[model samples]
Target: MSGQNAVREFTAQMSVREGRWRLYVALLNTTEQWPEHRFGHSVPTFMDRTDALSVLGFAPVPGAEWEWTEDSETPDDPASPVVLIAAIRVCSWSGVSV
Candidate 1:
């Protein structure tokens, strides 16, 4: 696979520290292969850092922002089953972090 394609297959995982948030991106590969699969991406944003931390079972840290990507694969037909590639977390105060 090309380097760009490899990066796309990777997911970003984020965690919060005392007053800062850390991000970790990882590559993921699937054993199963399917044709004509649809892919999608999304980010989770929170207004308050506390709220974001709460869901992560961590205490609210300073300069915390809520952000994450929701990536998945869906079938073209409504009745078709859906597949989730991976959940990517993008932590940033203003916009999504790479």
Candidate 2:
């Protein structure tokens, strides 16, 4: 399968404001291929590096164009260390079993 059609994982780092906007765009971009595309119908999740490593078993893969974010003040919510949002593609094709 071509890269566009192939299921893959992507990670983006952004502030809360930017992250929300990205989520919106991803939803729009993948709507036509809902459940088929990586971002299609996918609720992108925001996670910090630490949680991603420990809980999600994430490892850094190359080839992502990093964007610099300006640190800004946010409400006091320590539980929300969501700097990294991962967009992972999923494909399920059950072939006929003989």
The lDDT for every candidate, in the order shown, is 0.34, 0.33
TM-score of 2: 0.25
Q: Model 1: how far is 89 from its true place, Å?
A: 7.9
Task: Point out where model 2 deviates above 4 Å.
Answer: 1-5, 8-11, 17-28, 32-47, 53-60, 63-66, 71-98
What TM-score does prediction 1 earn? 0.24
Put down candidate 2 lDDT per residue, 1-98, tens digits, no spaces.
34445434434232334334332112233433221212323334434332332233333344433344433244466655445433432122221011
Clash statistics: count for each candidate: 1, 0
RMSD to the true structure for each prediction, in A, is 14.4, 11.4
**Per-residue lDDT of 85 in model 1:** 30
Question: For each candidate, what TM-score against the reference?
Answer: 0.24, 0.25
